[model samples]
Target: MSEVRLYSKADFSECRLTNHPLYSYIQVFFSQELSELVENSTNGTCYALEVGQKLCLVVVAQFQEGQTYPTSLRAQYLDYAQEELALTGIKGKRLLSGAFQLLKRIVPKTIDEVVYVGNYLLSTNLFQPFTTEELQKIEALLQRRFPTKTIVYRSQNSCLNQQLMENLSALNYQSFISRQVFIAHQSQVIQQKKTFKKDRKLAKDTTFNIRTNFDVTNYSERIIELYTQLYISKYSQINPRYTPAFIEAMKTVQNTSFTGVFDEENLIGVTMSWELDGTLTVPILGYDLSYPKESGIYRLLTYYTLLRVNDEQLFHMSSGVGPFKLSRGAEYFPEYIYYKRPASAKERRLSFWLLQKVNTILTRMSNKRAY
Candidate 1:
């Protein structure tokens, strides 16, 4: 018999599944302190789910109008929509713009209420698989709990979660490509890619210092500042606005590591990565962009991270920088979001069907582009 348990913020510490195999990994995101910190910073409310002995986190987010980044469906979908348009050509953008203007009001509000299963508040979500029977029960539980919200499972790629994706599809969840992500084996890149070698040498010979021993708790503010500078100010404000409290909580998490890049004692770059099941995923990475492009700050940060991956481990570099990641022997694949809506919500079903159609076109366009 499979058992499912849900823990809210107030009672998370009471969960008895601490002895579970993935508890250490779960603690990185779902520990009571960390969960509270994340909720305080973002629009998300966190919960812990335990099925049998496997554990994962869930975030129920109510996106407000004009919400920035991934917190809002409009922001998340638009970012990928723009990328797809860019790859196809300007003509596609003009056509899509008019269509978007026509549907903008209806689409955004329809996708606003979301229940993110396995949402770790990171670029990628690492999941411990649930059996089909277990998942069916879990799905029913979520539908009952969040009757009006769209249930979503994100950051799923076939390479990493083929069985899980199959299970979701079997349960009648709709899936669409969210974005292109890169996955590479460290040793193969080190041996085959000349560009990777050059970047490694550049990082090794650079005047800036790399420090893994620095106390992240002490520099939480600086870390958030650098992260905001790149992820929000330069890229898009739609990205999750993580706070210093979130960084400070990371200091005590096991199986996670933080690295800082410094130029003459000033913190210029920082990355926080965690390893699970022989895969290293760097969900938090940022650096000062005020320096000239010739300064090679970004290159140095990328190479330094590559060096941290073990020879046998795979690196899951989250979306964007397609050309840069591809040049270093990373293979690109589409990451997907699997979702389902309540049967009674006819309008939401229609909205999601429309979204599926739009995503299908975008996926086809993205697939045609050379990496």
Candidate 2:
């Protein structure tokens, strides 16, 4: 077991989580400057797990109150709550479940809440497996530190952390299948290059140009604008509303790139991606809605992204949009959300029931979409 210690604001810069390549995004999220931006909503705190004074693991936690769940979670409890309100008899059980879900979403001051952990902006797998005993100790340490709050360890990932999964199950944490991710096998996409010739030709036919950014200042506003028009304005409920501050923070992360598609200088599309362990992943994507869909702009962007993988000889390109990714030869990966509310028996029971109902509602929704 390692000794876990919390870093105070003064010495927080020393926490190694900030520089770890595997968790650079985590580092950016918990960065002093960015943390200040989100402080009103969440109190960002960092902890180091050290074995014999050598840092072994680092976890950044956000103590949030009256805050909704992390944006990574796509499930909308409000809609389910509204639907549940309209049901009756056996179906009315959804209403009970919805009520609890709603309550959990807008946690009041009574039970201090740590609603989620991990990257809030997208589905990320940063946590290394921790033993059951270590997890138990971590939970106890978190409880003691935030005595008032009922910490709910929230994790969303396409790939399962087997040990964490086992430990959560052993500890009686409720689990829910939140969503799915799409992975495009590089060899598969490359082998089918003949099929993409039309797309490549279309992209070349148009005078549109694509560019990548390390310092995003020049197009940050436009990126946010297009992102807002396509995602925030269109899908505010489910989208992760990234601000310019977040875009600016990307400047500090070494492994990330912001690629933009422009038509004679107008920024029409943007994709924020990270390359790690030979996998290129796109976490944020947006495009101008006013652009003529007939221009084949989005498809062009996809083609260019595939080129990135082909050029790098990377394994695969992982993206979102499950159906679209599948249509484009990308395989699907199931993503799950593991949550545990271990404060009291009542809280645990509510959470368990809520998890079941949420899963049911979400599965039904997914099936309808897939069908």
lDDT comparing candidate 1 with the true structure: 0.74
**lDDT string, candidate 2, 1-371, tens digits:** 56555544456466665445544455555564433433223433444343223332233334333332342121334432333234323344655565655755753333334434433444343444556776676667766766544444444344435577778789776666554555565655654765477777787788878777434877777877877786556744334455677777775676777777888778888888766545666656779888788887678767777776554434233323445555665665545656555455244456546557666865665444431
Question: Cα lDDT for residue 249, model 1?
Answer: 68
Model 1 TM-score, all chains together: 0.90
lDDT tens string, model 1, 155-273?
88877889999999998998877787888765655546888888877877889898989979888989988988987777765566677877876666666789898998899999898
Residue pairs with backbone overlap in model 2: 112-149
Give the total clashing residue pairs for model 2.
Answer: 1
Model 1 ranges off by over 4 Å? 19-42, 83-91, 310-312, 348-353
Superposed model 2: Cα runs more than 4 Å off: 1-3, 16-19, 22-27, 30-68, 71-76, 79-112, 123-126, 148-163, 189-197, 213-215, 276-279, 308-320, 348-355, 361-371
